[model samples]
Target chain A: MSDTTESKRLTTAQDYASLIDKFDTFLFDCDGVIWSGPKLIPGVREVIAWLRTKGKNVLFVSNNASKSRPMYKKTFDDFGIDTTDDELFNSGFASALYLAKILNFPKDKKVYVIGMKGLEEELDAVGVAHCGGSDPAEMEYMPAKDYTSVTPDPSVGAVLCGFDAFVNYKKYSKAHTYLTKNPGCHFILTNTDATFPSGGEFYPGSGAMSAPLVYSTKMTPTVIGKPNSHMMDAILASKDFDRSRTIMVGDNLETDILFGQNSGIETLLTMTGVTNEDHLLGPKKSSTVPTYIVNSLGDFKVLVDESK
Target chain B: MSDTTESKRLTTAQDYASLIDKFDTFLFDCDGVIWSGPKLIPGVREVIAWLRTKGKNVLFVSNNASKSRPMYKKTFDDFGIDTTDDELFNSGFASALYLAKILNFPKDKKVYVIGMKGLEEELDAVGVAHCGGSDPAEMEYMPAKDYTSVTPDPSVGAVLCGFDAFVNYKKYSKAHTYLTKNPGCHFILTNTDATFPSGGEFYPGSGAMSAPLVYSTKMTPTVIGKPNSHMMDAILASKDFDRSRTIMVGDNLETDILFGQNSGIETLLTMTGVTNEDHLLGPKKSSTVPTYIVNSLGDFKVLVDESK
Candidate 1:
């Protein structure tokens, strides 16, 4: 809002329609852009459906690594919006894809998962062997002095972390051991989101879960979610999409808008979630400015109605 | 090392006797200085007794927060060393003393503790009311989505974190809520030691336990242990000790030696524990150089034998 040429506030129906025509592919951030905690943001369904009807490619790119694509598809289905597993690229999928395709991980080696079932499922989907995640044995708290039984598997070539509800001393200890002892072990994290808004309150995110390991091992993991290029690489590698003709739509300016700007794609900021107009115009305006701004995706319904 | 005049390697018995005569008060770091794990370092007891025979004030200053002063005193007793609780200063005691004496916390407000029994005991010793530490209800793993039951007491004015074995999502969630919601709520951490050597292997320390909360809250706690002035302040306030005439003795250069350097007191580094000669002379040489270096505290036994 400091009169930046990149960000133009859309105030008219014609403005919305013209912006819609500029992009052939649309990427949406799940939490704030489309919905917020179990309910769809007003008119998001209509906007997405309208985009699909117009032969525009729509992809749900989320930083939520707690759920796999199939699990995410259930949420879309629950919201009455049509989405396939392939159309959803979440942090879990991005991490799995990055390991399997980009790094070309050894088939004999396994990934030590310090996350949830969703992350493990994605790894399994990509035929990447994994251990430690959601394992009942690892979930139990072991005394700090008792390290006789805490042994690392030599086959673990990578350690991947995401959101795990059962994050305990045992898991961190094992992850620390593997990272320190295992030579050439890859350290990867889905995202470093400090907190995620949910049910009218903020909850600890994946970053909080991975922090203990980072502190103990003194090693920063390769983050693969929003604001990092690994997710973009995974999306681009999996599908053919024109970056020039694509625009990112999200509510959070830091993660979502910045991700778009970093990926060299146009970004549209929506006010239905975490960010607002004041955020862009205020002294604390984020470094990454969106190309366009709208009150909500519901405003685009008027554009769809006008086109009809 | 690096041509520092402060660090003089003690070789001859005359050098050891000269170092002993330089300082009237001797501060010791427990883990590496006095003992390693469950066993006492050789001749450490004789050296301590020898120092006391010369009318020197012996105080144990450790970053370990897992035990209260009395509990720590038991370790000395177990090793056949005569010591009183008042002669010991640990992170747990430092935190409580800082809150009760330095901050002069409001009598009506209770402190929320995210630590073990030792931290709770020290808080109790200072006549401070605290909640959450070692509480069975708080130790249970609550689903990330469920925050309905996790409530903060309105009287909570401080959040203290230490080496908590029962650390879980619920405790972190409640602590975050108290920190964000409660007005003037202070955040305090015991020590930021990444790893502590135990049972012949390094394990995650109190800092690792506090990392999750640090990440989620995005707030750095006032650390009250080695290398921080608060611990030094706590020790100074409790007793009348002349900094010019005192010397800190320990094994770890980063924490123990740095603590002495920050406190304007002389330090002696021994090779009996975590640090060695290479650490002082290598590329990773610590900024805080000790006043004297010896192969072990047992080397001081030569001076005692010569004096006898």
Candidate 2:
């Protein structure tokens, strides 16, 4: 019914000025947009600081639940980027918020977690009860034939999953039992990233960690990360902002751009991360197109140049 | 294409007599048709012994790759069932055979394994050089932030995976590195069973174990187990049998019956384990129709009823 396919590119200082003038709120994705691995993208600090000077609400929306909010803030501090604690809303925090605020999880029931300590911290921060994650007992390997420990846990109301380095068959068996045997047990994931890029290659992500349960139980999980409206809601609850005056800026089309669209907002795509010029214009173009395009978020530095 | 869909049932002495006369060889599925867990199905011993007495070529085709040929023979010995070491063609053995004989894997290149000791034994039996599997170092867990240990290895020609209770981040990272970094690296699985039923419930199976790689790499591996023709070829390689004169006997229709159909052989469905009367004659009837059906493989013990 409407045209949202064409993405207008921002070039000159006038273009950047006009783009910034349209939105009072800006949501940014971290890994690819702000930095790559441990290396910070030049001018990222200048542009974000300029956004704060312009009285714009700058918040970081990250899908990585490998670290808690404080840890991410530490990363930002290490990068010398001026940002407050309330400016970050990661998938782990969103998932915890969904369970605590949106789902209104029964206080009596507990979550059977298949994730890292960061995810467990998020749940605790939200005042929700959880177990299994980072528990040495759950990490131990029972012989392949042993399933005696995989008993049905009636107390587990949800099986919350995220990235875990210790993902094993014991965790899968327990998750499978909870989903299959427990009545009305929810299956939730922080994000369904198939793999995460690190050490110049990809390793299995949170989605892959919980894949065994998905197969055995034939159940699809409610992903609480980018491209899902739940993450958007979590951000919205953090601060009141006009939806029309907000735009999501990131490097990934599948996650960032699609996420903005899912949240009923505009999106600005960048080429500094997983995407490139060919991705948007080549024969093998991605289906998830953004509302606007830019060479990189670093290009926003033009706004801070008084001479320009 | 004559229809091999409708299944005939054997009830009377004449029916059993005709059924035995029709097949010169019988391929039996161990877990469901012959036994359930540790308990052997009634009349299984009698039926197998009677088949041997009738000069029928008896062989076992199993998908459980957690055990090697010797281990499976030990299981048969524990149950007091009559079976030869060569009579069994498990998925692990099939996978090893596929790597060595079918694929003609280079002796200089080693396979990166993500499985248990049995799978390793099978690879060794086939004289295929391999690494990683059942290795204590691979079972150890590293910090979530550490990927320095996942450097690429050029010597790996393939990544062979099966069910492993000790599956952890190290094994996944290594497998991912070999598949992504190594050129022409093959991805092979012992079986793709989503879940294996045990302890009165289902647990993650071989397919579930490799799911992360499938999702991350966007590549499908060669599934060497049931419903795949590789298992059939492995069975054929072990013994001389006429496909037209042999029947595949099993309880489950999806794996066993489909495997038989893929092999261009007739299949006999049994109702002892996993499957029941309702499975064949219910509203949710399975699409994989067998050539013949029986209330139980034990009914074949009618041959032992001298009075009848």
Per-residue lDDT of model 2, residues A4-26, tens digit only: 56888888888888999999999
DockQ of 2: 0.72
Q: What is the DockQ of each candidate?
A: 0.67, 0.72
The local lDDT score (0 to 100) that residue B229 gets in candidate 1 is 78
Predicted candidate 1 versus true structure: per-residue lDDT over A131-167, tens digit per residue = 9999888778887557656676899999999988888
Query: Model 2 chain A — which ten-residue stretch has the worst lDDT?
Result: A1-10
Question: What is candidate 2's CA lDDT for residue B127?
Answer: 96
Model 1, residue pairs in steric clash: none
True contacts kept of 2: 0.76
**Which stretches of model 1 miss by more than 4 angstroms?**
A1-5, B1-5
Residue B198's C-alpha lDDT in candidate 2? 74
